[model samples]
Target chain A: MSRFTKIALIGLILFPFAFLLMLSLGKQWPYPAIFPEQWSLSNWQLVLGGSEGLGNSVLVSVLLSLSVATLSTSLSFWVSRHIAYHPKREAWLSLAYFPYVFAPVILAACLQFFFIVAGLYGTFGGVLVAQLFITFPYGVIFFSSFWNERLRSMEELVKTLGGSTAQAYAKVLVPVAKGALMTCFFQLFLISWFEYGLTNLIGVGKVPTLTLRVFQYVSEANIFLAALASCLLILPPVALLWLNRAVVFREG
Target chain B: MLTIKNINKQYKGEAVLQGLSFTLRAHEMLSILGRSGSGKTTLLKVLAGLETADSGQLLLDGQDLSPVPANQRGVVYLYQEALLFPHLNVFENIAFGLRLRRRPETEIKEKVNGLLQRLELPGQARKMPEQLSGGQRQRVAFGRALIIEPRVLLLDEPFGALDAETRRSMQQLLKRVAKDFGLTAIFVTHDLKEAMLMGDRLGMMQNGQLKIYGNRAEFIADESTGALDEARFWTDLQGLKLTK
Candidate 1:
C-alpha cells in the first residue's frame, strides 16, 4: 500500500520475468535492458530430466506439508480450546508456545539430535516431525482466536441442545470454524513445504524437498531448472494465499 | 427442569456469583435482565454447564447435574451472532446433529425438510450462512439448535446484534419456537425492555448476584426503585441546566 511496499511488490513480480529473460538470453554479465530478446523451451527440458528428483521433490513437499498441517492443527485445537474454555486456561497460556517462541534453527537442531537418538534421522518421518515444530506455531496462532471468539462462548448453547463436546465440535464448532480450520491446515502446509532450516538439517542430505532440490540445482549452477522448480514450488502458496489470508494467525 | 443451589464463582480475584440459586421448570421461558458485568452471562454459562461454581449444587429433573459434561446435558445455547457453519449450507447445518447421531440419510432429509416447511423457510436448504441476510442467518442458527430437540434452550442475547425492527421480529419468532418445542428457555440480556417482552418471568442481576426476580409485571415495579433514583438524577440535571 505504501510507496516502498508498492515498489517492492513490483520488484518481486518482475524478478521471475527477469530470471526467465536471463535463462533464455544471458550470454554475459549484466545485460542492461527492460526485456530480453531471446526465448527458448530447451531450458525447460534440460532441468526437467524426466523430472526424476523434481517429481520426488514435489511429492515429498506435499507429504511434508500435509502431515505437518494435520498434526499441528490437531494439537492446536486441544491447546486452544482448553485455554479458552477451561477454568484455569490462563495459567497454561504463559507456556503455550515455548517451541514457537524459540528460534527455528535452534529448535531444528534439538529436534535433529532427538531424531538421531530415536532412529528417525534421514527419513521422511523425521523431517515431518521437525516440520511440525516449524509450523505448529502458525496453526496454534490461527486456531486460538477462532476457538475463543466463536466456539468458546457457543459451547454452552450447543451442549444444552443434546450435543456432546465431540458432537458440538463435529456439528457446530467445526462447521462455524471451517474456514479457520482450512486456513490453518493450508498455512501449516505452506510453512512446512517451504521450511528449509529443519528439512536441510535433519534430512541428513538424502531427503529432497523441492526447496532442497532447488538449492541443489542452484548450487550446481543449473539455474534454468531451478527456476522451473521454483515456479512449481511457488504455485501452491500463490493459489492458496488469497483463499486462506483471512484466517487469523500469528500473522495477525 | 434445571435447578441451581447456592452456586458461587470468582473471576480474576473478584467474586462474580455469590451463593446464586434458582430453578428452570419445563416449558417455561425465563429472561434474565442485568446491567453490564452483572453476571447474567455467567449465570447462563453455569446453568448450561459451560462454567463451574466454586460451591453449589445443580440438578435437572431431581437428578444432580454436576457429573454431566456440557455436550451430553441436552442443553442448546444460541449466541447473539448467527454462528452458523461457513462450510455448510443451511440444510447441512440443520441436519448436523442428526448426522452426528448417525441417523440414516433419508430420515435426516425428511426431518430437515419437514422443519424447513414448518419454519416457512422453504427452499433455503442449500444456501450458505453468508449468503443469507441477518434475519435469515439467525433463523438458520435457530434451526440448527432446534433440530437437536434438546430439553433446555439457552439464548445469550441471541438477537442483540440485530437492528431494532429485526430484533423485535426475532423475539416474536423465538417465542413461537419455544412454545412449539416445549422448551425450558433461559434468555439472557441487559436490555430490560427486551427481557420484559420475551420472558414469562424476569430475574435482575447486579454485581454478580441475582438481586431481584419475579414475573414480568413484578420485575418492572422492583426495578422502578432503581429507575426512580435515575429519574431523580435526570430531574436534578434539568434543574442545573435551567439555572445555568
Candidate 2:
C-alpha cells in the first residue's frame, strides 16, 4: 500500500474513537449543526469526580473483567489439559460448546432462579458468575488445541527426568504457553468487559458495570454521558491489544 | 540390572505386550528391533513408568518399580523428536534436571558444561532448540537426559528423524557416550542395521512377543529375525554389480 493509502486507512480506523471523544466533551448539538453549541471538560469532570457513579462503574467493570479473565484463563488452561487427554475428550469438549448454544440473556434467565435461591441474585457475585458461564467455556475451547502429543511427550519426558508434575508445568509447559495464556486472558477480558445481556439480567440494575452504564446513558438519550461511557469501555481492550501486539512481535 | 517379568498389556482386549519378559544387565544397551505397533514403545514406556503394564514386575537393581511414580523411577525416555523444551537454551535444557533437584548453581554449571563438551555441543550451549540442526537438538536432548544420571535411558528411535549421515553420526555419539558413562538403556528402532550396530545384545519383537538372541551370530542365523533376508538382498545387489 502507498503511504497516502496507509494514512487514510489509519485515519478511517481511528475516526470513530476521535468522534466519540469529541461527542463526550461536547453538549447541546441540535439538528443541522456539524458541531455542538458548547464544549467543555465538565462531563469528564463529573464522571471522574464520582458524582454520576460512572467512576464506580468503571472500577467495577475493571475488577469484574480482570477477575473473570484471570480465573477463567487459569482454570480452563488446567482443566483443558485433563479434558484433552481424557478418554471422553470429545464429549467434554462438546459440552464446552453448550453455553454458546444459548444466548447470554436466555442463559442468565435460566440461572436466575438458582442465583436467587443462593441469595446471589442482583449482586456483583451474581454478575461475575453469570459472565463465567460464557468466558470459562470460551477459554477451555481456546486452549484445547494447545495440548497435543508433542506437549504430552514433553511433560512425560520431564517426569522421567525426575521432575514432578508441578515442575513440568512451571519449568516447561507454562513458559511455552505464555503467549497462549496471555491471548486467552485478553479475549476473556474482552468478553466480560463488553458483556451486557447477562449482567443486566443477573445484576437486576444493582451491579452497575461500565457496559451497563453505557446502555443506561444511551437509552436515557444522554448522548454525551453515553459517549463518555463508550470511551471508558474501549480503553482497556485497546490497551490490552497494544500490549498483546508487543508480545506477539517480540515472540515473532 | 533391570528385569521385566511376565509383562502383559492389552488395548481394547487385544494384546499389545503378551507375557513379554526380558533382563538387561547393568551398563548394557539392549536394542530391540520391531515395526510400528510391534510393542517396542509400550515396553519402554512401562519401564519408564510412563505407562503401567497390565500385569508384570519391573525390577531395577532388584527393587520393584511399579509403585514408583515416573519422576522417582530414574528412567528417561527419549522420543523420535528431540522434544526439547522450546523456551530454554541448550545450557538451561541440560541443567533442567539439576535445577529440579535444586542442585548448587556451580554444580549445575559444571555438569551441564561437561556434558555439552562430551556431546560435541560445546560453544552451542546458549542456542535455543530451534536454532540447532536436527542432530544437534538430539545431542542436547541426550545431554539433558544424561545430566540427570538416569538409571535407564529408554530411547524410542531418537535418531529416526535425521538424515542418513546425521543418523550414523548420532549412533556413534550415543555408543561412545553410553560406554563412557556406563549407561544402561533400551534403544528401540525399526531399522535392521541400526538394531545390529547399537545393541550390546539384540532382541526382535513379533506380535508383542520379544525374542532375545544369545549373540550377534545367533541373531543373524535366525531367518525369522529377517537378518538373513537383509544379507541376501545386499549380496544379490553386489553380485548384480559385478555382472554388470
Top model number, DockQ: 2
DockQ-based CAPRI category assigned to the predicted complex of candidate 1? acceptable
How well does candidate 1 score on lDDT at residue A241?
A: 78
> Which stretches in model 2 have alpha-carbon errors above 4 Å?
none
lDDT of 2 by residue, A2-96 (tens): 99999999999999999999999997899999999999999999987899999899899999999999999999999999999999999999999
Colliding pairs, model 1: A157-B76, A157-B77, A160-B74, A160-B75, A160-B76, A161-B75, A161-B76, A163-B71, A164-B71, A175-B85
Q: Rate the local accuracy (lDDT) of all candidates.
A: 0.76, 0.94
The stretch of ten residues in a row with the least summed lDDT in candidate 2 chain B is B43-52
Per-model TM-score, in order, reads 0.74, 0.98
Cα lDDT tens digits for candidate 1, A131-216: 77657655655665665655555655556655667776776676566666777777777778788877888887678888888788
True contacts kept of each: 0.82, 0.98
DockQ of 2: 0.93
The ten-residue window of minimal lDDT in model 2 chain A covers A243-252
lDDT of 2 at A230: 96
Following a full C-alpha superposition, what root-mean-square deviation does model 1 have from the true structure? 6.2
Highest TM-score against the true fold, candidate: 2
Clashes of 1: 10
A-chain TM-score of every model: 0.79, 0.98
TM-score of 1: 0.74
